[model samples]
Target chain A: MKSLIGWGVKPVDSHVNEKNDKAWTFKQKLFLGLTPGQYLGQALRNPFNWILGIIFAVGLPLIAYRYFFGLGAVTHASNDYPWGLFLGFGLFVMVPLSASGFMLGTTVEIFGRHDFEPIERLALLNGLLGYFFAVVYLLIDLGQPWRLPYPMFVSFGPAAVLFLVAWHVATYLSVQVAEVSVSFFEWIGWLGGKRFIRRIAIGLTVSGIILSTLHQGALGALFNYAPGKVHPLWYSPFQWIHFFCSSIPAGLCMVIVVSTIVKKTMAWRCDSNFSDNLDRCTLGLAKGASLALITYLVIKLIGIAHDNEWGYLATGWGAWFLLEMAVGVVLPIILFAYAIRHQVVKVARLGAMITVLGIALNRLNTALIAFNWQLYQEIPHIFEVIIAVTIFAIYIVVYRFILYRLPILYSWKAQPEEALAAEAVRPAPIRTTPSPAGAMYRKID
Target chain B: MSGISRRRFLAASVAGCAATTLAGPRKALASGTFSGYPDGMGVLVDLTRCVGCRSCEAACNKEQKLPAPDRPFDDMSVFDETFHDGKQKRRPDENAYTVVNRYNPEGGAPVYRKVQCNHCNEPACLSSCFVNAYTKTEEGAVVYNSKVCVGCRTCMVACPFHVPAYSYSSSLDPVIKKCIFCYDTRLKNGLPPACVDICPQEALTFGKRKDLIKIGHQRIETHPGRYVARLYGEKELGGTSWMYLAPVAFDQVGFDPTPGNEPIINNVKDFLGTVPMVLAIWPAMFTGFHLLAKKQKGHDDHEHDAEQQQGEDGGEQ
Candidate 1:
């Protein structure tokens, strides 16, 4: 792919071909301005695609097997442990990690921090895809995955915490689709939809904040029903706050982790605006994450103190809990502090990676490990693990597919007429900016 | 920014209103101390009188028309069948709605405990279900509507007694399987459940839940040292329909010792109460933040770039 780019291949970041000033057709756009052979060549050349192939070879069948033979075929399906890895990992773990959308939206839009604007669209796309795949994992895990709309249409259990989860996730998915579709509008040259979304951007952002808060906290509240089941060490009276607060860091750190990966792997796809601003944005996010991490750490201790389960700290489970905090919470806090102070983006990136893992660990502990602590631990079935990995692989594939084509990493350059319209409008679009980069792309005009 | 915030605030307020209307009435009905119904029936199982005969298990199997057991109802070897590496005893599942597990606490004789849904006054399954699949009936039988069940198995996660098992083996339509206290067949007609009816040793007593409370206390008061003084479900998780009297400690017979008196729903009410609060406060509050931010942006321009300021004002939010 890098060799192809060396041979003067241009990935589609706008509608026009710089060569003859001819409009790139939808086919050309889909292929990143490559011929079908070249598209296939680039895909096959990448070893990552081969790994995805190997996973899908085994995983797709297992997913079908689960559906055909029922969840019992691939899962332990034990009465003692109802929610296996599918939910423990898929729903509980994925949702918090995907919270980058609301966090960045609130920052760049509400707080008017346009310096973070370069990565805002990426954050939104991350949130959208993460949530979409979380639901995909859910559909695979559910007994009647097809009846997902039962809560909304057929029946209503509005009082249940899960009811809020279903409604908010569904509503928030639509909200995210609208939020991220601005990029698609630019990619497809649909100025009207872009303008319409721009008109209601504030409304959309405000709603995003509301839905994100309730659903993120509601996910934690679901565990409150099983007070006797989840271990006292992980369980808390203020489980919602613990979940909500921790997600602030979880979401921010996830953005850090994702942006770092994007920067390293796909630097060509990024504009100077993105690459130059990323480190600063990352450090800024790290600062926010450290603050949230401290709050989460303190509240976690407060939960323990309120419960008077400080005695559990000496026990093995307590050690495990402390390990989570030390690695996931406290270590990151210290690292972020030092990195921000020293302006070392690398250390902050490492902290972000660990924080991502820490959030995963914390959620996995609350939902799986520390759950049923009285009973013996139940390892997930091999097939269940395979299916989960498969879905996540698909998630990555879809994420890359968008990042390669859409203007998430690079600001899309509007045509002259569109630019005139953009100038007439105020503040321009979120990521789109007037720059020398756009001047370099104009062919004859 | 003000126009956008005002419109969004109105939209958010409507959403808040919708949340309230949707969650309010149902919660009001469920709120406060909801003890069982006035004429609710209950069962009192006296462990001191039980002989681990397995007759009640047989009666339950026959009554519910469950699949044929691997061992017949007469098999005593099933008592020793522990599962999940002996950490768990035989439990109610898709095949059987009730099971009797034999627990031999250290230095005590083997005590048999009938394991089934405790049918709490405020059932966790009832509260945890997003489909409203469970119901604590007027007769105190915590029944289920499998037709409405989406098979999320949240009920299984929420059931503290581990009674509501999923029919995971069925690919087409799996649902929660649990003892409904024979609500459909016998209890609706004012007849006792088959297990309670077929208790040859009279270990299971069936009557009004209120009367049964008195009877349970009387037995504990009258027969000194014969039974554990505490009634296992008189106030456990907001009073189960099936109360227990054990010869040994309740925990010795596989009961949770610290199943608090407050209903399981109480634990979640704190979070649930905040849903409306968050929905109401966040839009206006965050919009105010946005206005403040835009104000700062405007001051930076200082009337030099009026067009840019207007753009910032609209696009900032």
Candidate 2:
């Protein structure tokens, strides 16, 4: 891989490649010029990989068992609780966190906030992988995974909320793939692909925003089907609004959370532009999150009042609801506000973590814990938990693999002119000298 | 900068505003009402006359060709079954289309509520179904097409009565199992449902929904103290094909008394109303925000240019 980046090689323009030249075949792109040993070394060095290996070892068998024996093999399989952690964590929680792609695409491409350009690819990739993995989770949880597309083509359940979810998520996944493909173009030295996407970027971003708004809200609309099953505090007819509103903060904070983890765990993969601008980006994200959180908090209160569910607040479930609001929404709001004002990036990071937890809690409350409120609570079967974790680990591995290889955290080295232009745009600091080492560092950045 | 440009902008804005106002609320209003087909059929089950004999259960089992139960049809021991930490008494499932639950209320003879699909006049399962697998027949029973079912179980979620059950144990194909009011065997042919026909005690009444309501009222009026005043399904959850008359309170017999008079679909209308609005409005709104942000960026560029020029002058000084 290092030798492949040698100075004599001219970068391929994706637009030109698409028209005149053959693009890198899928096999060539997948290998990425790495020797098998380097790949294995990197894979084995991470402790996270060992954990993932253990999970896959345990969970793959259970997943097979579930298919062969039945859903009763790995799940509690109560007719009362048809959906469990699989749908709750996988579909509900994952989809909102994955909203990062459209949000960032709209910011940079449509809104032209180029300051956000550094993390834009990362967010798009996050969204694509999150959605892709969410579908994967659905496949595992579905009784008939093979018939997944039946709702789209075989049968038409146009009136059903799940029908909307199926169509939108499928469409949105394709949009996200197109959005994220620009990074793949750069990584494989294809500039024509990049330029063509850039030309249609505004249209794609706008469409992305529209699709994401409906589907994110649609996921919430799903819970409205079970008004009696979900606890009152979580169930609102305006659930779609609550879901859409909360997702704004959830998506922004997820970027903060993921970026924070990336910075800590894989700093070498990030360029200085990304590493240095991260704190400023964290503050910017915190400001956005605080505004969203306050709106969410107010509307949540309104939902309670609108339904006259204030009396339910005195009960244990209400206390649990309050706890979720306090820890997840309210506490994070205050923390983000204070953190942004004081320029406390660490506190903002902590607030982002809390907000992520809050989003998970809210989804779980709706989908599982408070589901069938009149019935006994169900803990996920051990095998079921392992399968969920294993799938998530696969998501993380794919996320890291893309981040490591793609131009997400670093500018693509396209033409020498664009490289020089990027250098000129950067605030000149201590490294203007033309020593051989300095030139190499400059090229690397 | 010119009057003509301003006039053109104003004209465009007016057109856009006109288009939005015309399209927005009209679409919302269209999705709100879900009045069932006027001539759709419905059934009325009178529970007060039920004697807990399990005759209807046997009849339904035979009519549906379901697998035999572990115990004999005459076994009373099945009624004592409890599940989910004793929070639930056994109701209907995939094999058992209808089950009689014994709810012992205070100061009342234990009520035997024969539970099955109420087959709503405006069925939530019908509206919530994306593939349109469910249909409300003019004969009044809600029937489903198993061929089209993907078994996503949205019908299970949409059913306010918790009537739809999936055969999760099946590996290859699973369909939502519920009482179709014996649509294929009897209801469609102008025959009373098998369970209704076989009931020795005349506990189960099968008639036009309107006529059944009148008969229930007449029965209540004839014997005031023998039954509760209100018909259980007359207006609950926007009315059901199977009506109930109980000597004890409805809640005592495992019925949810407070599922509002509005149909289950009504609860979802507010969200569905927003879908088209979002599809129409979000594009322009986000695009407008983009244009505003772009304009701000342009202003920032001009300020940076001014600052750059000032810095050069200071360097020369």
Candidate 3:
């Protein structure tokens, strides 16, 4: 009668029995079978939480102070450099990285790449958390956060590229919520809800593709509003294409990176199916990422050529630009290719980490560093950096909380006997009709 | 549900049509060449007569009723002000709508350039505002409505001249601060802005924009040695309501000599054009991919069954 629920997947009956398990409730499920004091102790003992504690100590007050005392209190508040790090990192960088939901949704659902099914839920969850947190970052940065709905309800500047970005991002957030909700429904044992979602799943995914395509490109086109202000090297008529194409690899590699982190740090949460096939999934994602990286590099070069910005390459900015390409784009391409050929997942993981860094660097450079190339660089204020890091920490906490509980990296257990029945009724070798995803919802004996 | 009531359906269709027609004209201006409204007012700034006096800045401050400056307007020492960026002289900010910066050319005398909103014909701030908070008035003023503004600061970034500043010190209510060409009080009443009216040396000329352009060229042609032949704002960013003629080259006096003739919005049209294409094509394209995958799965299932039968027969033999 000891708890079967520890740090791994918890089925419906894992904490519930006909006699005594009925006493265990949502509170027990939330606490992961540990007492409240034990949970607090476990959290405090982790060194990472201590670092987060220190960040929130300084940063939470700063955020409150920013609202009370105004943006000028914590920021240098230069009108010339209006965007700063809040947008450069949070909106611009995070949006592209969160493209994972649509990417994996397409791979597994649309393309019928069922090998990718194990990681699809994880990708969807990562995408949802990233976008939700990006909005949180935006609220901190906006001067009038309460009026965030102005673009949608009060007034419409349909001509503006930012107007497109605003509307699409809002709609896409809902799409991501619905897509990730399937896992949430499964975890909560709502078979009916999961089935309803599965029925409209194709409609949701197609809209996701449309929304992701427009908004990811729209973020780049926002810079087109500042023609001479952005450096010639970074600004192009094809800036939209550059952002959209690079996001493909960024999205794919982000999935690999998140899965790798989950496997290394919290293997107990992963079922054997996930742990066993993770290496193969990593290589498959790396193949997609390498193809995207190569396409991104060529399009970037084409952008430079179309603009005839070859002369800027001789300057210091051009050298920095080349270094970003070499490290972020070229090196990842070579390493991913090498890893795929040699079947070295460790090397592919390293490539993914570098790619994430590279994408972050590219967004920062375009938004802050290379902006106003003639003027001096705008170094983000100390408080601004702290708030950014704090928001990112909150993102990680929410991400981990969900991954630990949801049927993302592992399958959820149905009723005790039904779960066993499902195992017994696994699809025969020659039987293939409805997708595994659809078949997963079949009634078991 | 009974299909929408007939009255409701008719009302909805009428409202939809009305909205489309109302939005139609605005969409037309988002692309193509936009020379300003024909009767738009303009200012001609003759830099030779400015004489480094800060009267325009003082006049602007008084008219706008902005917060008092750290240094008094009469303080001549303000001419030597330096910004946090090591070399930048004061540009316009929240407190003052206009500023006069003294740019001293190497061997010549000091030239004072008064900086404020240029009131662009095709204003980037107006185009980039997602909330439609900015309006390019027929009076040739780029005006803002702070009530609808979400203050995302895209306007500040989009301004080529860096004219708009935000009231970042106001926690409860922060808004963009920029010169509106005194549209509500002065320009609409057929009177010049306070700064133009108070110019001691007739340095700032107020007239029709077309007339000012002709006047600007006449002065340059008449006194070629005293002026650079180029008029600063006539063709910059698709022309502006304010034009300047300076003795020194425009860059020496802090004007972007080559800001290009195309307006900022033109640079974004190509990307915007592709948006509808993507919306139209992606659904069909991806749905086709899904169908193809389903078809391939069917083919694979057939092969698997055939192979199983062949293996069963071989085992029996």
Cα-based lDDT for every prediction: 0.85, 0.75, 0.81
Tell me the tens digit of each residue's lDDT in model 1 across A1-445: 7889899888877667878887789999999889999999989998989999999999999888888889888997588889989899999889999999999999977787767787889899989988998899899878888789999889888779898888889888988998999899878877657766655677788888888888889889988989888999889988888888888888889999999989888887998878888888899999999999999999998899999999999999989999998999999999999999999999999999999999999999988899899987889999989999999999999999999998888877665555546544543433343356522221100
TM-score of chain B of each: 0.91, 0.83, 0.86
Report lDDT (Cα) of residue B312, candidate 2: 35
True contacts kept of 3: 0.64
Q: In candidate 2, what are the lDDT values of residues A150-208, reduced to their tens digit?
A: 87678765656676677778877877887888877667654446544543455567667
Better of 1 and 3 by lDDT: 1
- Candidate 3 ranges with C-alpha deviation above 4 Å: A1-24, A416-445, B1-29, B299-317
DockQ, every prediction: 0.54, 0.34, 0.37
Clashing pairs in 3: none
Q: For residues B196-227, what per-residue lDDT tens digits would candidate 1 score against the true structure?
A: 99999899999999999999999999997888
Identify the leading candidate in terms of lDDT: 1
In Å, residue B152's CA in model 2 sits off its true spot by: 1.6
Off by over 4 Å in 1: A418-434, A438-445, B2-5, B8-21, B24-29, B299-317
Model 1: lDDT equals 0.85
Q: What tens-digit string does per-residue lDDT give for candidate 3 at A1-445?
A: 0123444424332324334535346676576556677667667767888998888898889889889998887776589899988899999999989989999999876786777777888888878887898899889888999999998789999888888887788878887888888877656655445644554566677778878888899999999888878898888888888899888888888888899888877776777767877888899999999999999999989989898889999999999999999999999999999999999999999999999989989988999999988877788889989989889988988898887677687665453444333543432222223223323222111
How high is each candidate's TM-score? Answer: 0.95, 0.87, 0.90
Q: Interface RMSD, candidate 1?
A: 4.2
Lowest lDDT 10-residue stretch of candidate 3 chain B: B1-10
What C-alpha RMSD separates each model from the true structure? Answer: 3.5, 7.3, 7.2
What value does DockQ give for candidate 2?
Answer: 0.34
For all candidates, the clash counts are 1, 19, 0
